[model samples]
Target chain A: MLTYIVEDDPVAAYLAELMIRKEQFCSEVQSYVNGQRAFDSLKEANETGGALPDVILLDLNMPLMDGWDFLDAFDSLAIAKDVCVFVVTSSIRPDDIEKTTHYKHVRGFFSKPIDEKALKRMQHLLEVPNN
Target chain B: MRTPDYLQAELLDLAVADATLFNFLHGTVLDGLWYWDLQAPENGWVNSKLWLTLGHDAQHLPPEPNAWQAALLPADFATMQQVVAAKAADAACHTFSQVLRFHRLDGSEVWMDCRALLLRNEAGTATRLVGALLNITREVEKEAYAVEIANHYSTILSNQSVYIIKTDAAGNYTYVNDLFYERFGYDAQIIGTSSLNSIIEEDRPKCLDVVAQCFVEPEVPHQVILRKPYNNGPVKSNHWEFKGLVDEQGQVTEILCVGYDVTLLTENLQKSQHLLEVTKQQNLRLQNFAYIISHNIRSHSANLTSLAKLLDGNGNADQKAIFLQMLNTSTAKLAETIANLNDIVTINTQGAIAKEPRLLKEEIIKTLDALNVQIRQHQIRVEVDVPADLLVPVVPAYLDSILLNLLSNAVKYRATERPAFIRLYTYQEPGFIVLAVQDNGLGIDLNRNRNKVFGMYKTFHNNDDARGMGLFISKNQVEAMQGRIEIESQTDVGSTFKVFFSTNVDVDLYS
Candidate 1:
């Protein structure tokens, strides 16, 4: 399975990419500093004949198109159905938790810096087949 | 001068006629007469015609000698008895008279002006007494009616709230009602002796001047401003309307002045002036905030747009990679600025207060750890003298953001000549926790820009990292928590920032 990390903070984003690659959380890892370019790649992957990334780690605080706004626009694109999105944010606000849980495409909410424990948990969940 | 029997009888009749002749010589007055014989007391004759007009009958009256005394009111009985006893003491007395009540057969009473003529023989012994009574009821009723009306007028004058001052033609206060006395803190007995001038000397001169103008011009009311000292040691102002009183001879004898208090009007005017000043300052702040948002956001957005265009156009592989990297960095920076602006917007739109508890020591330690690399690079000395138990009652995110901004600014703007020395301390002041953040950095010229340091987008130093949003956001967060931020700084020396947080937070007072 392929994994993607989308975050605006270069330091935090690279850290997330390193954690996933080291833990073998997925077969391959790709990093994007913003949501728009990452979303364009996901759309192109759907049109071509290849398996989509099994998991996408989306950072909420970003430029032009934030995570929430990107998710709203991505739902209309109808790229793939099996892929899961995880909202990763530094904000520990209660309102953010309440908001991300309502989205059907979102699997979980995680705080930064994404540690090895969360990467292993994701690896285990992604290995399980959907009913 | 006794003549023959027939002549003597005629002379006696003439003498009696002359004595009673004054009755027919009437004037335009309400006086009637009566007569009584002491030897034959039942033969008393009251003013029969006057009593008849008051619905009385003379024939059916009591036959007792002093039956008329029943007509006297119970209150006047004792006085009438005294007068009668004095008259009957000496029978040889020539004159006996008393103003007594005459009860007619119809059970009606009338006041009578009575006078008596005594008839005495050669031994100076009284044989009979002839008395006369005049009806003076009309004059008594008129006088009593006048007094009742005056009493009603006084009742109205005393109950009124406004100050009623009646002055003679000379503008001297003849009557100051009870309201005037109580309101001006004067004695009720000061009605006539002391004038309005004595009590309110400051306002009196102007009031008298206005009255003089009214006197000069009849029917024209003079309005004057009367400012006088109250018991509270403040000069209370009033608006007085002076209505002059003039006699039929066209001479102004007194002034009827009515004054109303206008202190509230003056206070409202001052409040409106203060509101105008505050509104002007807010307008200026809004203008500066808009300018900051436009200039800062546009700068990053333009850089990103141009770099993207350069990468998309013709370039070598290395140059393209470099342009692409530059574009991504610029876009990320733009996103960060937008995020900060969104935070500001969120804080501004909230209609209620926040309920976020932040541990002061935890937040400070986290911010220092985040800037640990910079600390090592600068070889800076960090002295955190805050009490370990101190916890600020604030929203967690905002508290972190405020302290982070202040600490970063201190480290980033250090003086070039000296090694950076930053100190953080907290102590209890009179009403708040005084949190001091001191840095031996390039101190600000506070005198030149004292009031504008916390203002939106105001930067003094030429540091590239000073976008000016940090202090502004910090200030907003501090004010939102009902705390105040003050700064003491001098150029080349150091800067000390004191944040005062009230200790009255009920959720966690000091835990």
Candidate 2:
């Protein structure tokens, strides 16, 4: 499995990449500092026959572009990758949590500092058929 | 029995002379004259003045007693009969006088004073009656108008809600209307006593001045507020317009005061002002809360989460130790931010704080003592120019906290080249007491940071202790006590923070 981490903070992005590699949840782990860069890469891969990540971990707050903008652009693209999106944020505000329901590709909402149990749960969801 | 022709002509001349004398006397003194011969009622006699009084040609009037009666109003004719009957019942009353309404030949009525005298023969039997009529319409209309004017003024004085009072030239109450007694609870005992003494002591001098001015300039109105004390209720506030009542000779006769009670109006105005102030403070607190949640709380949480993720990863021993140290720092920072947020929330959402008159100098001195170490280390020169007895309405804790925050900020942001100097002073504004704290330190670029100066977690200086929460909390505390904070600063010159407290703070707003 291939996965992408889109986060504004370098430390959070690096830690997420390490966690994915250590758990062997994905064959390759890519990272982007902002949603704009990740969206550009995804667009290019969709046009070409390039490999697309099967899962994406998105952060809400970023400088150039944010997760909500990326979701809007990603939903517009006609890519057949069957990629699942999971929102990862430190904000426990009810408004942010309620916003996820507007996007259908979003599979789950996760709080910050994703633990081993959360990672196992993600893995279980990935193994499920038609997930 | 026929005498000579000359004798007959002489007799006729004598009769004509007598008739001419009678006509002359009747026309001069009365509007009309009439004679009724009982033996031949149709052969009555009337003078030309009767036609003139009736507004008709003399030729149009019939010389008959019934013709004269027909010209009178029916009611006046009945009244005339009663007067005649009363005169006849007492023969000693030879003349009958009645003011009766009479209809003219032109179809209009006239009020007339009619006097009739009965003529009796030698046998003392009444036979012919003669009368004189005079127009009295103008006199009757004048009497009616006087009565109508009197009734109109009496109604206004009795029914109106306005308090009317009349005082002698020496300020003694001469008369007070019903409304005055009802509104002020003053009895008849107040009469003949000085009414100026009823005003509150603080306002007595002004009331006396206004009264004296009115006396000097009669009919020129002056306004004053008087307090009327009660045995068991609150003092009533009466707003009065006073003017001197002047006589025709331009002498001041009395002081006329028209007033209405304004106690309820004043109380309602104060209540609405308090409600408006409370609403403004609540809106400001809500806005501050939104900012704290979005910036302060979220920033700290993000840092903690990022640090935790780093700790969960594998690394070299040296790198792991550095990560652990950063994680500890982040955790402590998060905890400190939460504590600061809690403090702010408490100050914002707390119930009404108790406010009392506190000495401004004492509060400043307390704050200075608490910051003595920092002041000495920095060699700061502090000047307190406030009076020792100057009282400001404030919450004690809020005053202490506000002073401490401003003084410490002055020390923390001192200029590097020069020693710090701080000045604290107090002054009076229109309705506020202002305590100003001025500093000679590294000032802020207000043009750039004006909006964010009092915002939570907004740091302008590059100091380790500049948490940026001090000013924000100080502002909240001051506002909680119905006060406000104003700032004036330049980039590198200095800054002055002025806090204002309302002068009259004993109004029971929260209570």
Candidate 3:
């Protein structure tokens, strides 16, 4: 499986990459510093019939473009595969978590530093059948 | 043409005996008659009709000067003595008339219309004073009852502690009651003058309309709110009700007005409305502060948590070094946010901030001097349209901080394509001094980022120095001084920030 980490902080992105590699959760992982760059990559890959990531880690607060803006643009595209998106933010606001329910592709919401237990839950979700 | 012998003899006797005719005049034609011979005070006569109505023997009774004292009411006698008899009995002033009260044999009252004519001798002195008295008891009683009713209503209108004014159809003051004179510091001098002059200039038109309506629709009452300017105190406001008073012929003759002072009620309502608006704005601000404080601290701490976990685990020496450095940066950011929070809280917890009058031009000079380095680097031209000694009441530190932020912001966001110019202006509002700063620079995307422009840690331009805390702190400081700030801008167009300082202490930002 391929995964993408769309976050602004380089250290946070590096930590996620290292943890995923250690767990062997995916075959390969890529990183984008902001929502804008990630959205451009997704759009280009969709147009070219390139490989699409199966999972996406999105951050809510970012410069240039935020996670909400990216989601708003992402909904306009037509893709054949189901790509599970997880929102991650340091904000303790219940409203931000509640907002994620509005997007169909959004699977879960987590606080910063995706933990071991949370990763295990994701792995279990992947094992489960779509039905 | 042919008359009976008896009727002819009766007519002939009326012509031959004039004394008998006079006796008939005294008996039936006149109600009562008296003749006082001033030349001979003892020689006086009172006709029988004069005393017969009182059930007394008065057939040719000798009428002395004090003969009627027992019958006349003492009060009415005193008034008659002062008025009807005041004029000397001479050829020039011979006649006198009055309504006098007397008593009957049953001790009941009787009102008499007494008409007296003086008969003067060759020496021009009073000799015979002939007075004819007619019983006017019913007419006087009706008049007295009408006066009693009028007095009852007058007492009610006067003692109610309100303004009662009567004006002619021309709006001239015919009357203003005692309460109006005592409470509002006016006098009878207002009489015969236009009532519109007493109303403040701005409220004159409304008052005129009310009075005109009173004339046009005399039955329908009209109301108006008028402000009265005082000589020694603040202007007072009153709610006035005007109604037209019509004469017996159904023509509007005068305007009757009643007024109640509403200055305190109006001021309290305004204060309450202003307080409500301020409270709502403060609540909204508190919510923003809560959300920002939560987000800012958590962002830094979340980075620290990640760095700490990576450092604790088994990692290469190089990786530990990288995580350690990130941890340092995160801690620094957290400390900065805490400091900013302290500044914001200080604004609320502090008492009334001390203010001083400073020249607006001098303040601009000081702020410009501080931003001189940035101005030179950007090659920006600054224009000042403020007076040399325009005074502004503001806290010194707050003014300096606000100016530094706005002036620096102008230079910091300069557009490179054209020559950059900034304008500083000052003007007067009703009770405020407005300092406007206009810039030709890389204007903010107001449509997209208006809400977030003053938010903590919200950086739109991604500049190295864009901490985004400047505007938030400036806003808080401005509010602390009981002043306000407003912005007008469009995307790609320049922005003008207007900061208003209250010239009066009683003035409120919301008001």
Candidate 4:
């Protein structure tokens, strides 16, 4: 399994990569601080016929391009539909939770301070996958 | 009382010769008498010289001469001839008086009172005529001067628009001007003899009482307010006021008043009060938003601090991994909130100018298309009904932000049990273009939280992923474009948000 991480904050991105690799959830885990760069890499991967990321961890508020922007762009790209996405944010506002139901590729929502329990839950959802 | 005729002539001749007897007769008589005949035109006789003052000759006049006709003013010539002719045919002693203008030898004019007595013969015909002429010009002039003064004052009172009322000490009007008739719809004939209290209805009793008070205390000038209903219309419920009236003796005899109608002013005051109330409500919402943002940010920062501490501890690989992941998520959220705050602050501090022309319908479609993935995933039906030709005066960026915010909201809050539906349309109302975005979503309780929905980080529902910043940003962007946003909603039903902007496509904002 492969995992892709899109977040503008460097510390947050590094920490997520370390956690995913240590948990043995993927064979290769890649990170991009901006959604545009990550989107570019995903487009390249689509042409190469390589194995796509099994799980994607997305952060919504970012500079230049954001998680929502990436989702909009990614929907147009002809990529594997089975990739699972999890929105981990500190925003506990009602509109954000309600908004997640709008995306068919979104697995679920997670609040900040994501402990081992939340990640293990994401692991299960990703393993089962959407077809 | 006639003596024999021969004795009367002898006595009159003897009397003319005696100065004492003539003076005695002249002193006692009210009339100055003279006699004239046709036999001797130059030998006419007057008893006294006082008669000569009224253009009469005392001597050398004809005995049977038409002296009255020669002495008559041109205006009285015809009437005098007819009177003399009628007197000549009768034996009766006839006496009559006429008022005529007498032109004196010096060319000065005097009004005269002329009286005549005719004496006739046995055939009942006049033998002689004697008359008296008295000057009465001074009396006529005095009477005319008094009438002229009264007429001048009445002319001023009737023509003036200001209320000029004259009342007695008991608050009864002796006179009121034509303005009183126009203002109260009262006939002048009816008002002349009527008391002022009769027209001062019960609703205006306070004004009447003030007038009464001014009269009782002769030094106080009355300040009475005449509050009449709004004039010339039935749809208005307003009153007008006029102040400052005083009577002679430095007291308020009658309340004179003049004022303009203030219906529009009163209405504008009420509208201003409503706007102030709305602004106060908005201020409360903004304060709450600041509090919520602080609380949410503090929570995230505290989580990050705790996770950092745990990662620093000598923990197992799994525990370290979990803490680090938590730290990363907390930092991202903190950064997002900071960015949202910056956007809100920018909107408030900077005065914005939207000088560009933006097509309102095109922007709506682009936003919907951008949200196409969400639209399809939720099985939503979005109807874009805005006319392609409709354009609004706006900045392109703000227009894009507003459209995106509204479209995303419609898709995000769709009812779970049913397919989502959104309707977008634009219509031209008077002086404005109205764009409406309506959705069948879990609508908010507008009565409870509409004021706070656009507040930063103020969320109504308990959903764990709500940031509560989208509507806030949208509101700012719309306002910066010199537009307004209104929301109509009910819980679990739907929400319709209407945006209003000037429809003028050629607005030159740079000017």
The numbered model that scores best in lDDT is: 3
Question: Please, what are the lDDT tens digits per residue for candidate 3 over residues B385-467?
Answer: 99997888887888899999999988888767889999999888886899999997778777666766766666667587777
Better of 3 and 4 by TM-score: 3
- Runs off by more than 4 Å, candidate 2: A1-131, B1-17, B36-46, B62-65, B104-108, B120-128, B181-191, B197-203, B215-218, B229-235, B244-253, B280-295, B301-511
Q: Could you give the TM-score of chain B for each candidate, in order? A: 0.57, 0.53, 0.53, 0.51
lDDT of 4 by residue, B381-489 (tens): 8898987877678767778888888888788788888777999988878867889999988998876565567765555554556666888888877765556788999
Scored on chain A only, each candidate's TM-score is 0.89, 0.94, 0.95, 0.89
Candidate 1: tens digits of C-alpha lDDT, residues B46-111:
444544534546574345555444555665556644565466567646665566555544676666
Candidate 3 docks at the CAPRI level of acceptable
lDDT string, candidate 2, B1-511, tens digits? 7659988888678768787656566887788887877445445676778778888776665656577767778887677666666666665767777787877766767888878888877766657778788888788888889889998887788655788889998889999887777756778999999987776687788878888889888798899877777433678788889999898998888999988878898888888888888778677668647755765456556556656666676668887786677667667766887888889889877756668889889888988999999899889999999999998888888888888889989888876687779999888889899889999888987865676778665566656556668999998887777678999999678999999887767544464
Model with the higher DockQ, candidate 2 or 3: 3
Q: Score the docking of each candidate (DockQ).
A: 0.01, 0.05, 0.45, 0.03
The global Cα lDDT (0 to 1) of model 3 is 0.81
Pairs that collide in candidate 2 are none
Interface RMSD of each: 14.9, 6.6, 2.0, 10.0
Model 2 lDDT on a 0 to 1 scale? 0.79
lDDT of each: 0.70, 0.79, 0.81, 0.67
Instruction: Give the winner by DockQ.
Output: 3
Q: Which residue ranges in model 4 land beyond 4 Å of their true spot?
A: A1-131, B1-48, B51-73, B76-79, B82-93, B103-108, B164-179, B182-184, B188-219, B225-374, B381-405, B412-484, B488-511
